[model samples]
Structures are given as C-alpha cells and as structure tokens.
Target: MVNLDSSIAFLIYITAVSSAAAGVTEACKSVIPFLATDYEARNDCWEDHNHAARLNHYKRFFNLLISVVAAGVIFGVMGLDPALILTGAEKVYVEDSWEVGTWLWGIVAVFGSPFFASLLKIVEGFKQSVNNNLPPNRPRQKVTGPRE
Candidate 1:
C-alpha cells in the first residue's frame, strides 16, 4: 500500500538509523570496561589502543548518539513499533505488518542491525568457550633430555 518512493526513502533512513546504533554500541564497548572496574581490560582495550582509531571512533560515536536520539523521537511521535520488523520468521499475525506501515519496518531495520551485531558477538564468545573446554585428543608427549 505504501508508495515506491517512500519505501526507498525508508531503506535509506534505516541505514542511517542502524549506523547510529553501531556508533552507540562502539562507544559503550570502549567505555563500559572502565566503568565496571575491569581495569586490565580497560587498559588494553582503550588506554593502550592507537590514538587515531579512538579519534575516529569518537567522531562517529557523538554523531550516531545524537542521530538515534532523534530516531527515538520519531518512534514516539509516529506511534509505530519497529520490533514488528523482526518477526519475519513468524507466519501468523505477520499479515498485519503490511497494514501497519513501512515506517515500522524501516525503524526496525535501522535499529535492529546493531542488536543483531551484538547478538553475533555473544554467540562467538559462546563458541570460543565451548571450543576451549574440549579435552585434548591425544596424551602429551613425554619430555626428554637433550641427546649427547
């Protein structure tokens, strides 16, 4: 039911929204360690890092922070729920999505990508933990003195 031009515009809008999400996420990744008393990690993750990277990070960080704040306002003013965009897997009740409007889907796509990225990171950690706990396949070789 939505116009083609509006649908395209929504796509672009979400792209900006998602990147703004990424900026907030990145800012938190760097700042949270320091706030949580993880001094060693904080030092390694932020204090010991290259200066150029941190500068670039802050530039996007502040921009996206402001961007998403506005997006949240749009969400409130429009009275649309973005979470509906995430229900692609559900066959039932999804028909209502079309009636709900493209704006809802647009908002979700913009905000959802960051949450998706975070979810991936958490999954990666779980995988690494599982891999680390597996026992060695073979017995360790015995150490021997140097031959004459």
Candidate 2:
C-alpha cells in the first residue's frame, strides 16, 4: 500500500482526488440542462443584464455545490481517508464518523483543482532549479598506470 504520510504521496493523492472532483463537476454540467446553459437565458437569447447576472451567480453556486458533492462522495462514500500535511508539520488524517475534515478537504480540493496544475508546475520548476544548482560530479580519470 502507498504511504500517505509522505509529502509527495499526499500531494499526488490530493491532486488526483481534486481532478476527479473537477471531472465530476464537468459531467454534472453536461447532464444538467440548467447547469449547462451559457447564454443569459435558456433560449440562448440576450436578456437584461440583471437577469444574466442572476443566472451566472446561480450557475456558479450550483457548480460549486456539485463539485463539493463529488468530493464528498470521493472521500466519504469511497472510504478514502482525507489527509494533508501543513508546512513541515506532522501528517494530519481525518478519520471519524462525522468526517468533518473530509468534507472540509473536499471543498478545498474542488476549489483548488484549477490551481493544482500550476502548483505541480511550480514544484517541478523548483526541483529542476535545485538540480541545476547542484555541482556537477567530476568525471573519473583513466588510470593507465599505478596510482601515485
């Protein structure tokens, strides 16, 4: 089994869960007609600014709700323990009947999905930077004769 206590492993696990929640939100948008509407009105005709604004607000709320529900299902019903490590602190796992941390993490995961890619990019860049800054190893010299 994978060790969730490790930083890298936890990062991968959270990212996967967040991406899955995002996918679920997208799927919900496709299946729900109201959630899929892009125009100001359902008929795809231009409507009053206020009406369009209201629709947009409602759509955003529903999208967030769907994302949260998806995350909850992933973490709760799926029996996946929600865990995270803050800074250099010890690992934190949320395991309880109520699963408050699970829901909280679910919300964070759903909202943070968009930024996860960027975060991974940043991490990769940092690793590359560190690797580049390290001194290169000296090539071994050929010893044609006995060492001095």
Q: Give all TM-scores, in the order shown.
A: 0.30, 0.66
Candidate 1, 1-148: lDDT as tens digits: 3433333333444555566545655566577553223212335555556554555566555554544554554445444343433332222133333343534444465557666456545555555666689653577898999999
Q: Kindly report which residue stretches of model 1 are placed more than 4 angstroms away from their true locations once superposed.
A: 34-107, 110-148
lDDT of 2 by residue, 31-75 (tens): 998888864544555566668878888998998898887887787
Q: State which candidate has the highest lDDT.
A: 2
- Clash count, one per candidate: 0, 0
* Clash count, predicted structure 2: 0
lDDT of each: 0.49, 0.69
Q: What is candidate 1's local distance difference test score?
A: 0.49
